[model samples]
Target: MNTASWGSAGRFGLARYVMAAALARTADGGAVVAIVLLVTTQGGSGSLAGFLAACITAPHLLGPFVARRIDLADDGRKVIAFACVLYSFALAAAVLSYGHTPAILTGLLLSISGCCGPLLTGGISSRLPTIVGSDQHSQRRAQGWDVATYGIGGTIGPSVVAAVSSWASPGLAAFCLAVAAFCAAWLVMRLPYSAPEHGGDVQNVPSAWSTIALMVKDGPLRRTLYMTMLVAFSMAALPITAVHMTTLIGSPAASAAAMTAAYGIGNLTGSIGVMLRPLRGSPDHLMSVLALCVIAGLFAVMVSPTLLIAIATFWLAGIVNAFFFAATLAARTEYAPAKGRGQVFLWVAAMKITAGSAGTAAAGAMTGWDVRIPLIVGIGLIGCAVALSFVERSMERF
Candidate 1:
C-alpha cells in the first residue's frame, strides 16, 4: 500500500478555503461581540440584546433548507461567494443601529443578513473534501486546517470588537468586521472550485427527511451531534460571562478583553498544535480528550478567585476548543456516509449556531443571577457528554 503526501494533495485549494473560512469566522466572532456590547453598553434592554443575538443566530436554523442549494449546486464556490457578498451588506446594515438606529430595524436587518451565515460556515465546511482532496487523510487534514482558521478568527474577532468599540465605537467595530465578509467572498471566488465528484447517482439521492432520519437513527452520527449540542450550550454563555469577567477584574473599559484574549491566544496555540500534530486517534478518544479539556478549563475558572487565574483557565478552554473542532471533523470523516454528507455538515454547523443562541438566551434571561451560573452549567453539560462517550474497534465500533 502506498501513502499519499500532504504536498501531493495540493495547497492552493486548501489555502483558499482557509482564507475564506477565517474571514467568515472572524466576522462572526466580531459580530457576536459587537452586537452584545453595542446593545447593553448603550443602555439598550437585556431583552433587546438577546433579541438581536437571536436574530443573528436563529436564521441558521434554516441551514438545511438554505444549504440544500450548496449541496445541489454545480459549483458551491459561486454559491458561497454570492452569499458572502449579500451577508456583508446585510451585516453592515445591522451595524447601523450603533448610530442610535431603532432596535426593531436593526434586528430586522440582522435577521436578513444572518440567514447567509450557514452558507459561509457549513456550506463552506462541506466543500472541504472537494477543495483539498477526497482521500481520508487529505479530508481529515483539511478538517483540521478548517478548524485552525476558525480558531484564529474566533480568537481575534472578540478583542478587535472589544478594543475598537471601547476606543472608537461599536458601529465602527462592526463595520470594520463586516469587511471580513467581502474578503471571504473574494477568496472564495479564487477557490480551486471543483465540480461534484464523478459517478454518484443524483437520482438516487435520499429525501431530506429520510437522510435526516437516517442520521437520527445512526449511533455515531447521533452521538456526534449530541456532543456538539452540549458543547454549543456551554459556548453560548461565554459572551455574557466574559463581560462579567471584565467587571470582576475592575476594568469596565476593557471588559472581557483579557479573558477573551486569553481564549483567543489559547485557540491560536491549539491550531498550531493541529498543524504540527493533527489528532492521531479514533474519534471517541479525541472526543473524550476534548471533553476533558472543557471540563478542566471550566473547573479551573469556577475555582479561580483572581483575574489572572481566570485568564489561564480561559486559555486552557480555548486550547481544548480548537481540538474539539478538529476531533469533531475527524468524527465526521469517520462516520458520515458519502451520501448526504453535505446535509450532515450543514446540520452539524447549524446545531452549534442554534445551541449557542439558546445558551445565550438562557444566560440573558438570568440577568440578575450570579455570573458563575452559566459557567457552572457549561461544565455540567460537558461532563454529561463525556459520560455518553463510545469508543471504536468493534469494541467501540459499528
Candidate 2:
C-alpha cells in the first residue's frame, strides 16, 4: 500500500497524478481569461466580464468545505473526480450561456465551477502525504514535482487561451478548458486508491470546525499558514505594480506580460532545482533562509531602474518563492494531524486566496498614487513574515 517507492509503478502513478493535477489547474487558471476574452469579443461590456470573473472566483473561499467533504467521503477519489466533472460541466455551461442566456445565468454556472475549484488545488495537495507515505524524503521529492505543476498550469493556461482564441474562436478556447477539466476528471479516477488510512478511524474524524481548531493549536502549522498568507499578499500585488511600472518607464504593455511569464518560468526552474536537490535538514529552517532571499529579490526589484531589470528581479523572486512554497508544504505535511490534513491544506489555501484578494485591492487603489507604494507594502509583508519566523524559532526554545 505504500506507494512511496520510486519503482516503475510508483513513478507511473505519480506521473498520472501530476498530469491530472496540471490539467485541472490549467482549466481553473484559464477559465478567468477565457471568460473575459469570450465576453469582450462577443460585445459584452468589461464590467459584465468582471462580474462573471468575480462570480467564478468568489466561491473559491468555499474550498475548505469541499475538502471537508472529500475527507469524509467513503471514497475520496470519487468525490474528487465528481468535483472535477462538475467543474467541467459548469465551465461548459457558462461558455454556452454567455450572450445566449441571461448574464446572471452564466454567472451562476461559473459560480458552481468556482465552488469546485479547491479540489483542483489544495485538495490535490492534501493527498500528497498519503500518496508518498510518511517518508520525509519521498514527500519532499513529490512536493517538488507537485510545485512544478502550478508553474506549468499558471504559465500555459493563459497562453493556451490566448493562442486558441486567436486562431479559432473564444468559444472554442473556453470549451477547450472544459475539455481539459473533463480529461483531468478521468485521470483522477486512474490514480491509485488510498494506501489504507493510517492515522485513525475514518468514521471518527473530527468535524471541520474541530479540525480548524487543531490546526490553530499547532504552533508550527499555524506559523506556516500565517507566513504563507503574508507571502501571498506580496505576490498578489506584483502584477498591478508591474503594469504601473510600464507606464512610468514608458515600456510597452507587453513588458508586464513578459514579467508575468518570467515569474512562471522562474517558478518552474525553482521546482526542478528542488527535485534535483531536495532540501535537507528542517523545512522550517529553509523557510527562513528562503524568506530572506525573497526579501532581497524584492529589494532589487524595487530599485530597478529599467522595466527589463524589474522583470528579471521578479523572476528571481519567483524562484525563491517557489522554494519557500515547498518548505511550507513540507511543514504542513510534518505538522498537521493526519486526520485533519485535508482541512489544514484547504483552509490555508483559502486564507491565501483571501489575503491575495485584499492585496490586489490595496495595490489597485495605491497604483494611482505611486507604483512604489505597493512594492514597499510587499516588502513590508515579507519582513513581517520573516519576523514571525523568528518569533516561532524563539518559541521553540521554550
- lDDT of every predicted structure (CA atoms): 0.76, 0.82
lDDT of 2 by residue, 128-164 (tens): 6666645667779889998898888877888899999
Error of 2 at 52 (Å): 0.9
Task: Please write out the lDDT profile of model 1 over residues 293-379, one tens digit for every residue.
Answer: 877877776677777777888788888888887888777767777656677877888888788778887877654588778888888
Clashing pairs in 1: 391-396, 392-396
The whole-model C-alpha lDDT of candidate 1 against the native structure comes to 0.76
Pairs that collide, model 2: none
How accurate locally is residue 352 in candidate 1, as Cα lDDT from 0 to 100?
81
